[model samples]
Target: MSQTRFGNQIKQATLTPFEKEVIDGCLLGDGTLTKSGKEYRLRIEHALKDREYVSWKFEKLKRLCISDVQYVSNHDSTRFGTVGHPEITVLRQKWYRPVKQVPEDLVLTPIMLAIWFMDDGTKHRDTVDISVHSFSEQSLHLLQKQVSLLGIKTTVNSDGKGKRLYILKKSYPSFKRLTKPYILKCMERKLP
Candidate 1:
């Protein structure tokens, strides 16, 4: 009964399998799961124009959130955060070691890739670019390898800012097919 109340907070919120999938996708993008002592909380922020997107995410993980999404006037962004949870702490520890890195044991799923695409993917003339600038060269290589396991091929390129994984033109069909099912309607504009 402890977690039954509509607005009541759980002492140690347990994440659902779907929620874990959400977190994994977010970690690959800009979302931060911060650790304090033994607890970790996920914070999601996006442009005010993306309020609907963040709201969608909020709805998916509402059980862990104590408050509704907030508008940050300074950044002109919408943001929300989850309450601390030990389950989240485990993920943070696995994905972050001083700085974010691709988890060695990661297994990408369609929904997870869709979330990541919505977060960082951009469509080019004949390719898709997923910004992985924050990751080291080694981490990016590992990510490329992981993506290949699904039969999609990609290459890492570096520009003025940093590295990004470019889904080759030939693989666009496969990429689209794999991620389209999980792509949110609001983010369909990003696809070719």
Candidate 2:
């Protein structure tokens, strides 16, 4: 009753390259990897106003899910998550060690950046900020370096407790160039 290809057994759902990027981006913000028995799943939640954004994610990931997007009136929020999979469990190991943390070799693409921005980015006038407050300065430095790979210069700023990756106004043009196309219209408020 199992599946095989070219005499090789095919495991349960594996993430496509694009889906991996989407997961990475989401993990940078609202996404969490939760253990479900032997596997782990990717879960996301957003305020009601961001339902369109959740729908966008669901459309990309529905192949892994059975439930439609849910509207929980009690919390007034929209939410969805993929079914448990071993691939997600592997990601959980890398992303969460007791507490969530960025992986050591986190490479990023433009679209991934867009996804991260949509989930957590805040527009401040002509500039933007990726609110990664749960991370330490060293971890923010790691992310700051990854964004630099896109040629957008960012500074890591701290507010006594945690750090934020501040994309400078001068670099907003470049940042916008990479993330604008993938940013959903529903999340356009995050852009200037």
Candidate 3:
């Protein structure tokens, strides 16, 4: 997953002359103006679109690799990110139930937990504050349970119509703490 290699590979791929000129112009930060430049600009846009398509292709490849590793290692596979559905499945496999139960102590990092709140349609703030529409008593109880697991204390307010708001007691986790590098290091190593 080296950017340099990826860049070289892209360079090696056949490209229209217009695309090459546009890419060159873009790299030089030269605004396109001439007739060929305009065409180059269009080609650049096309290249960008193609790049996005390629990125998606790579993502699928990575997922497949992860899945294969999981299968060989007999580990669980958990998928995160807003771009895809959330699920935990058997390693190297399409969605399947785990042979072993996930532990209750296995809490999501703060950043990952944030997704749950967002999915519930709550607005979160930097000040550890969250606002949400009315909740059912069951929903409120569930929210409290999850918050407790995250070691976060929350103060709740109700508007008497089941409407509730909660303020988090701690700072949001820093991006560095939630980054992939840190997370991968923390995860149990896959069996070789």
lDDT of each: 0.84, 0.82, 0.31
Put down candidate 3 lDDT per residue, 1-192, tens digits, no spaces: 674455334334444443322222221111111222112111111123133322332243332121211111232222211111111111102201121121233333443333223222233445333333433454455555655665566666764544444545252343223322222221212101
**Deviation (Å) of 74 in candidate 1:** 1.0
Estimate the overall C-alpha local distance difference test score of candidate 1.
0.84
lDDT string for model 1 (1-192, tens) is 333353234535567788889889988997998754457889999999889999998998888876899999999999998877777888888888868998888888777888898999988787688989899877887788888987789988886788788899999998999998878888877876
For model 2 the TM-score comes to 0.90
Error of 2 at 134 (Å): 1.0
Q: List the candidate 1 regions with Cα displacement exceeding 4 Å.
A: 1-13, 35-38
Provide the global lDDT of candidate 3 against the true structure: 0.31
Residues forming the 10-long window of minimal summed lDDT in candidate 3: 83-92
* Poorest 10 consecutive residues by lDDT, candidate 2: 2-11
Better of 1 and 3 by lDDT: 1
**TM-score per candidate:** 0.90, 0.90, 0.29
